[model samples]
Target: MIAAAPASGPLWQQVLVALAVFAAALHVLHDRAPGLLRRLRLGLARRLLAGRAPLARLLGRWVAPPPPAGSGQTACGACQKAGCAPRPADHMRNTP
Candidate 1:
């Protein structure tokens, strides 16, 4: 008996799925390692900018470089501006 071919859907659906997966991977990378992600983006943008071709330059316009690490603000933007109180205890609540 001959085996049947796999039921593959439209090319666009596959492309969309691939793009979504790629985006999610990038998101995870950014969330887990923000500094590494920032470096990667800055490096890519610089490489594009360094290219002589106009298309590269145009693409480089996107992927803006992250602000200098020192100047970067916390999520709330108030912690660095004002002062944050230190926690009385460093141990986790779940752990003794």
Candidate 2:
């Protein structure tokens, strides 16, 4: 949306012209602000955290439910429920 400054002028002249135009525009918009910006921020935050139902539905899709209690009676029972093969205790015992 912005047009570049004229390229035919000297570099210092171009720099001064850009600074003057920026300062003049800033002076004009210094008033009549803040009302719309505050409302936009509130609307965006409301959209981000709209309801607990949406969050619960997303969690359900990504997470597998835990195995029922009292089902794992053996040493490697926990890994079996998680669908991974259990490692021998010798591998785990020497690490820590």
Candidate 3:
């Protein structure tokens, strides 16, 4: 029986593994604490893109808040119209 040698990957593989771990950690953070992540992104964008209105507008588009629950309309200024109308509740009553 041949013995298997210990596995040692190349430097690039090690770097890739580290990057994957970092990305996974970021994904978890974003999922678990989306509000915190959004605030951080907005703050960074504001700081980096200050005094640049066009760039700020682009960043604002990315960091805009999500639509209200069940509203089916985005809070972003792109939509000028209101959201969908609320459905009326069924009014049928039990009949003899």
Error in Å for residue 28 of model 3? 0.6
Candidate 2 local distance difference test against the native: 0.58
Encode model 2's per-residue lDDT on 14-83: one tens digit a residue: 8999999988765564445544444544555455445467774454443433334587656654555643
Please give the ranking of all candidate structures by lDDT, highest first, separated by commas.
1, 3, 2
Cα deviation of 8 in candidate 3 (Å)? 7.0
Residue-level lDDT of model 1, residues 2-86, one tens digit each, is 9978859888998999999999999999899988898888888999999999989888878857578778465566365534643
**Backbone clash count for every predicted candidate, in the order shown:** 0, 0, 0
Give candidate 3 regions above 4 Å deviation. Answer: 1-9, 51-96
Clashing pairs in 1: none
lDDT of 3 by residue, 1-96 (tens): 999877588879989999999999889989999878777776766665664688777776666555446764544543545443323343355457
lDDT of 3: 0.69
> Where does candidate 2 stray beyond 4 Å?
1-6, 34-96
Evaluated at residue 69, the lDDT of candidate 3 is: 67
* lDDT value for model 1: 0.80
Candidate with top TM-score is 1
